[model samples]
Target: MSSRTYPAWFHRVRSLVQDRKARGQAFRYNDDELPTRPQDYDEDLSERPNDSGDSDQSSILSDISGNASSEKARYYAMKEQRNERKKQLRDRRTGQGSNQSDDEWSEETEVQKELEIEEEEIRPIKEALTEAQQSPEENSAPLKKLGGRLFRLWSTDHVKYCTFETAPKRYIEFYDPKEFRGFKTYPDGKIDGHIYMVSDDMCEIDNFTPPKNPSLNFVRLDGNGVCHCFEVQFFDNHHLTLKMPKDLVFHRQAISPPSEAPEVFTYYGICEKYSDKLYRAKQRKEAQGK
Candidate 1:
């Protein structure tokens, strides 16, 4: 029994020594032993750890190469994540990043428009009342006067409130002044029953007599510088000619009435009742049922 035990124990010790060599071979893989090309490793795994056929330990080298490649892949993945975060930040800066729906924005604009209309609702009625209260005196108040300028309201059987500006013969050339109101807003001024041409310039007054038409107090400017001189000319929107003075300039509702027209020796065309309705050439034609 002792002799048998001795051989068995000796065999076991030798086998242990060979197994250690196999373990050491498997662990021999280092950084340099891996196949540089994948094709080379695929061609043949020629060095298994336990094989005795000239084991080259290629599997250990392959494991080291795979670990390095895995580390590189993880780095690229982290870089991609960082780039995505940067792109998100860039999108936020431009106004392109919108969170609310378009309907909400449209509703906000509509509310702003409604508020503007509400703000202007009271103006028209106030303007109408103010005009209604403007009496003849208030409308004809003297604006500051300068030399070579005349201001006055013009009234006629055709149209009333036809305001005008006139240059008298004394100061300057016969130019039209702008401080006159037009036919629409001359307030209530009237000339009735007949036509009259009174002006400072007698020749200009005589040159404007109608064909066989009668007129009253037709003359030149007396000591007061009033020009009864007038002409019958067509105005805009008038059916017939307007009896405007040649020296007077009438704007199309442009000039304000002068303060001096009422103070002068204004000639009346001898009417039965005091007529307050002023006339324009067109309006007179309409009133005649023409």
Candidate 2:
């Protein structure tokens, strides 16, 4: 006969049970010492009073409300942290901070360079919506006319334009007279941002010489306080073109109703509608290929 070997944990548990039994305390096998279920075990727990002299319902409600408030607090805290991080990044980029490692500085520098390249690949289109908000009399006729409409990127000279090439659909909308929003809808994700726009004399690409045709210059300030300047090469009722640094050309077409403010201000609805369109277009193209 072979002796049975027990694991070390099993021996520990057995010793604990034996110690309890020696002390006349209930062990695992002591069913008689266990408390019996109350007759009202099936009754609603919410109707019972808790230790604090409040009904269980009140405690549960308090817990639910507390969880919701805590979640909201956490969300705002995260947002503040993100804003602070972005501020630090901007400060470092502008030579205000020197504490960053060489690798970190190099990485951020490359990001800034990429953003500069992307800004040059954007285009524009016409029709203003909130003329009263911006005081139409203060802006040029061309600037005022460029608001309140959504412009879709039709074509771009740069094949590697990140926003244009990656997104199945992309749009730029001057939601407010001086505020512009750009959004791109991808198959699995979306990107959107808003920035304030102002007129500028300096062009990113053609700083040495002025544009040959009558061109409108715009300097856009993003959340990170980075300024991107692009020249509006042409703008009309249906078409708008932009000239950017490195001689990048972006042509845009007006998609929404002319001169009318968009019904929905947020990008969610717009992106949803466009995403569906993109899906259908892809299906059609696949069918044609077959």
Candidate 3:
């Protein structure tokens, strides 16, 4: 079909071609196998120029070219033009038009290049991952006891402990004492291997931080009464007494000996605030306001 009657896309291409010709621009995509440039376009168009004007003259001599009944030759000639048009359309669909200059194609080709580069880059990383998966588990440090005392939180069903830090966030209990699993003690309680730590309070556990000082014996209230030590022994249901220092009384509210007193604050003994961080934050706000 003629360019005027053809589809919209074909008209756009035809317009681009005409515009290129008027502007003296180079031709890019063309059906001819031979390479063409702007200068070559004029030559190609000149061959078919004003075919209508020469139509009558050309028809007068056309009788000598072929017989009217050369059915086979006529069939092949028409087939050739149809095939050529199909090829042209296919090339445009596949981004293969010669009119598509290298510059324009470069932009389109860049997308393809990027995809190729991504695949290339991912290949090495994938190979490394495969190799890692095939390998055995990496050597890790053996978990050994790093001597530190443990104290349980207040009397509750919850399992929590306080390492010497400001708050408690650990879950430590004397492994039934007779379980042979010993406890790690603090400085004063660090004698040989036992600890005299205390349970301050409980909160969200994080690093199992150890507490400071906290020996069963303190100048403050170390007494002949009940001893303040990290671990307490359940001498019986009614009496949970100090068991670390064989010769010590696990003091309760009732003082055993009046003249002497057990240490009031030790790893075994704990003091708690109603709200863990509330008071401190409130103080800070007040100070800032001042």
Among all candidates shown, the one with the greatest lDDT: 2
Report the C-alpha lDDT of model 3 over 208-237, residue by residue, as the tens digit: 222232222222212222333334322111
Alpha carbon lDDT at 100, candidate 2: 49
Q: lDDT, candidate 2, residue 186?
A: 23
Q: lDDT for model 1, please.
A: 0.27
Q: After superposition, how far is residue 191 of candidate 2 from its true place, in Å?
A: 22
Stretches of model 2 off by over 4 angstroms after superposition: 1-144, 160-167, 177-226, 246-290
TM-score of 3: 0.16
TM-score head-to-head 1 vs 3, winner: 3
Q: Cα lDDT of all candidates, in order?
A: 0.27, 0.32, 0.30
Quote each prediction's TM-score. Answer: 0.13, 0.22, 0.16
Tell me the tens digit of each residue's lDDT in model 1 across 154-265: 2221122222111101111122223333522222321111222222322221111122222121323211123443433111111112234422533223444454333322
Q: Please, what's the RMSD in Å of model 2?
A: 26.8
Ranking of all predicted structures according to TM-score, beginning with the best and ending with the worst: 2, 3, 1
Candidate ranking (lDDT, best to worst): 2, 3, 1
Clashes of 2: 3
Instruction: Report RMSD (Å) for each prediction in the order shown.
Output: 45.0, 26.8, 36.8
